[model samples]
Target: MTQTSNISRRRRTKQAKGGADYEAKRAELLRIAAELFKEQGFQSTRLLDIAQAAGLDRATVYYYVGSKEELFHETVEGVLDANIAVAQQLIEDDSLRAIERLKKIFVSLMISYEDNYPATFVYIQEQMHQVAADETAWAQDIMKKTRQFDQILIGFIGDAIAQGDLRGDIPVRLVENALFGMLNWTHRWFVPGKGMTGQQVAESFWSIFIGGMVPARADA
Candidate 1:
């Protein structure tokens, strides 16, 4: 290759490597920040704290992310997208019974919490309040996305009731809110070695749901 062509090739190669490295590093930084946010609330976390947790200096972090606020938003969005994407997939599975899909949604989320810090989800949910109190349109967008999952879940519960599984007397919206209330509080007490696996905890809790909603045996 001519000298100018050689220079162009070298520049392209360098840019490609830099882009790949940035992606990898960005993921690492987000992981550390997420865990830290879970350990401490978003307001309590600092940029330096994230850098130290990620084993990087402040300058490197700033090079990748403009500010802690930006990083927090990215991290929260990452967790929210990952979580709902999975639930959406399950909700859309036509082959699975709606009730089973419902159970799977709970089980899958418990696994996510078991793997990712439970606070990742709590962070996004708690942001709903902060954004709402500020009267920002951003909260409306967030809620719009959030209600997608709620609508899907409400449909699932309604299907179960229609199938004579859940009680018809109970409102679908009420059951939906109550189920989330249980899941949302898991962050407060769920821990890795607390004498139960994530799946076990999910199954146990889901059993309560099943018992309460499912019709009692005619003989009993």
Candidate 2:
């Protein structure tokens, strides 16, 4: 190979390694931030805390992320968006019955929470309404997606009621709220290594919830 070509090849290799390192460090920083946010919360966790946990100084941390708010945003938003998308898609799937879709959503979400770990729990713990009130664009967007996710569940529940799958006497919004209570409350007590996995917890919750929702058939 020509000397010039050899130098170009080496330069490209160096750039690739540099990019990989940057991404790897940023990912480490995000993992640390998520753990801290889950433990200390958004207001209490500082950039310095994440930096120290990641073994990066404050200024160095900024090279990977913009600020504490941005870091928190980074830690939570992707998983939240992915969950919303999955729920939306599951509800839209014509092949699945309403109850099936809803079950998939609940189970998928629990698996996601466990898969993402502290990050999803951190988002669960955040008061997005208060965060949106501050008028931060990212916060407002998160709030918007949260509402969209809720509406998806509500709509699915309404359909199920109309189809005679779920109990019709109970209000749709109430059912939706009850489901949210079961799923979102996992943040408080659902540790991954505890006897059951996320899917197992989800299945147990589904069984209990569905028993109430499914109306009993008329006796002869």
Candidate 3:
């Protein structure tokens, strides 16, 4: 290889390693920001609070994740991106019945909520009114991702209704909203018991409510 070719290869390797280091630091900052946001709320939590939580100076925190609003936006983005990926998987899987896929999504969402409560807390608890008031480009993307989930959810409900799993009489929008309302409200009051797990709680929701929604068979 030419001398310049060897130089280029080393440069690329260094860049890749640098990128990985950047992401790791950014992720750590995001975690600290999420918890502070959940505990004190978006408006109350400032850059200094996040910097202190992450054990860094205010300027160092910005170097890692940007402004407080931008940091919060990225936090919400991570959770929504994960949830969307799971929903996409269930939507594409042909093995599971439509109703079954729907139930799996519920369980996955609950599991996500348990593991990433701070991120979930941001999505469930914070209103984007402040973000919108700021009018930054990052804030603009927030609504798009949120609406994207709503659209995908509507698709799932429509598929279930089409397969005769959900009642056709109910409006699609209402069904979608109702499912989200059930899941989002749980974060506020639902507590897991000693013997029970988040997955079990999710299953219980499916077992109880889905049982009522799905049509009954004549067979005993």
Candidate 4:
């Protein structure tokens, strides 16, 4: 081959290899950036800080993520998707009763929060801030997800009520909102290995959710 032709071939090969390397490094950088974003609020975190935390040049960080806001959104969405998947799996189990399924969902959510405290904290903060800043948009988005989960819980509750397993006087929406409030609050106080396991916390929650908000029957 001519010298110029050989040089051209080497250049093409190098570009191809560099493209592959960039993708791999970009994935790693995104992971590190997510951790940093979770540690510091998205507004407080700087691109250079993320790059430094990821051990990459600032410009290279831009190659992986377009902006800090984009990175923050992606990170929060990834965690939310994973959590929805866990809930979907638990609800799909045919053998478990409605109460049992609800227990699984609560336990799994608590475990997820405990395992990913940083990501969960960031998500919660962003969601709260967004809601406070723009009530309309935030309410719509929150209601969309809330309604989706509410449908699942309502279905289970409806089945239990039909089977005489639970009280029928309570509205399904009320039940769903109450349960969501109780379960979602766990992210605030749930510390792992502080003498209570996720399952134990779940059971305590179930006791309140299943046993009714009011006093139990006297004829036990």
Runs in model 3 with CA error above 4 Å? 1-21, 128-135, 191-196, 216-220
**Candidates' TM-scores?**
0.79, 0.84, 0.79, 0.70
Index of the highest-TM-score prediction: 2
Put down candidate 1 lDDT per residue, 1-220, tens digits, no spaces: 4754555565455546787777788778777776777678777889999999888887656666756766666765555577789877876688988888788887877777777654455464456468545545645655666777777778888988888878888888898877766777776677767888888988888988787887766798
- Candidate 4 per-residue C-alpha lDDT over 67-141 given as tens digits, one digit per residue, 9 for 90 to 100: 776665555556556767776886778887776676677677777766665556666756555743555653566
Instruction: Report the C-alpha displacement of residue 1, candidate 2, in angstroms.
Output: 46
Local distance difference test values of all predictions, in order: 0.73, 0.81, 0.74, 0.67
Q: Which pairs in model 3 have colliding backbones?
A: none
Tens digits of per-residue lDDT, candidate 2, 120-161, equal: 777667854466676778778888887898888887788888
Clashing pairs in 2: none
Residues 1-220 of candidate 3 have per-residue lDDT tens digits of 5754555565455546778777787788788877888788878988899888778887555455547777766667777789889988887888977777778888888888877766676766776456556566766776677688778778777888899898777788987667766777886775545456778878887777776677555594
Show where candidate 4 strays beyond 4 Å: 1-31, 128-146, 192-195, 213-220
State the lDDT at 64 in candidate 4. Answer: 62
- On lDDT, the leading prediction is 2
The candidate 3 region of ten consecutive residues with least summed lDDT is 6-15
Comparing 2 with 3 on TM-score, the higher-scoring candidate is: 2
- Models sorted by TM-score, best on top: 2, 1, 3, 4
lDDT score at residue 96, model 2, on the 0-100 scale: 89
